[model samples]
Target: MKLWGGLSVLGLVYAALAFGIDQTFKWWMLHVFDIEARQPVALLPVFDLVLAWNKGVSYGWLSGDASQDLLIAMSLAIAAGLWIWLAKATHPMTAAAIGLIIGGALGNALDRAVYGAVADFFSFHIGSFSWYIFNLADVAIVAGVGLLVYESFTEGRAR
Candidate 1:
C-alpha cells in the first residue's frame, strides 16, 4: 500500500521492459530485416512474421481517413489514465496490469507519431481461420487485461 514499494517498482520495471522490447523488435523487423519487402517468414507451423501498418484501432476499425493527431491524443490519454491507476494500485497484479496497459498504449502511440500507424508483424492461422496480425505490445495489453479480469473475479472471494 505504500508508494515506491516493491510492487510499485516492479510495475515500473515491467512497463520499461515491455516498451523497450517492443520498440527493439519493431526496429529490427522494419530496419534490420526489412520485413516489408519479404514474404511472411514462417516461425511456426501456423504462425508467421509479416509487416502490416494499422492506421486505426484494434482490427483496423475506424482507421481509414482518421487523423493521426487524434489517434495519438487518444492513446496518450489512455496511457495517462493507466498511469494514474498504477499509482493507486493496491495489488501487485493490478499494478503489473496497469503497467502493461500503459506500456502498450505508449508503444502504439509512438508508432502513430513516427509512422502514422502501428506496425503489426505476427500472424496466426489455423487451417482456414486466421487471426488478426499484431505486435508484442498488443499481446501485452491482452495479457494484462486478462489478468485484471481474473483479479476482478477473485478479489472478493479472497476475503
Candidate 2:
C-alpha cells in the first residue's frame, strides 16, 4: 500500500515537472525571445529554433481549417485515458512513462485550448534534410514511448 502510494506520488511529480518545464520554455520562447517576430535562430550546424504552430496531430496530420476543436477534444480524451493507466501502473518505469505521456498530452492540449495550437520551436536539419519541428513536450513523450517499448521487450524476454 505504501509502495503504491509512493509510486502514485512519484508519477504525479514527474507529470507536473514535465508539464511545467514544457510550458515555461514555451512562455520564454513566445514572450521573452519574441520568436514570432524573428527568423529561425541557428543553435548548431544541425539544430535551430523556429516557431511553428501545430494545429493537428503528429507531423500535422488531420490538420485542416476546421479541426482545432476536434484535435483538442481528442487530446484531452487521450490524456484522461493515460491518467487512468498511470493510476493503475504497477511498475515504476511504466508509471513514469505514463506520467511523461500524460504530461505532454495535457501540455499540448492546454496549448490548443489557450492558443488554438501547439507551439513548436526546435528544428533539426542536416543540410537538405529536415525533421519535423517539435518542442520539449514532444521530447518527453518520445522518451516515454521509448521506455515503454524497451520495457515491453525486456519483460517478455524475462518471462
Residue pairs clashing in model 2 are none
lDDT for each of the candidates? 0.86, 0.86
Candidate 1 to truth, TM: 0.91
Q: Per-residue alpha-carbon lDDT of model 2 for 45-151, expressed as tens digits?
A: 99999999998888999876578888878878887777767767879998898788878888888898889889999999998999999999998889889989999
lDDT of 2: 0.86
User: How many Å off is the CA of 67 in candidate 2?
Assistant: 1.4
Per-prediction TM-score: 0.91, 0.92
Q: Each model's RMSD to truth, in Å?
A: 2.3, 2.6
List residue ranges in candidate 2 displaced over 4 A.
1-6
Clash number for model 1? 0
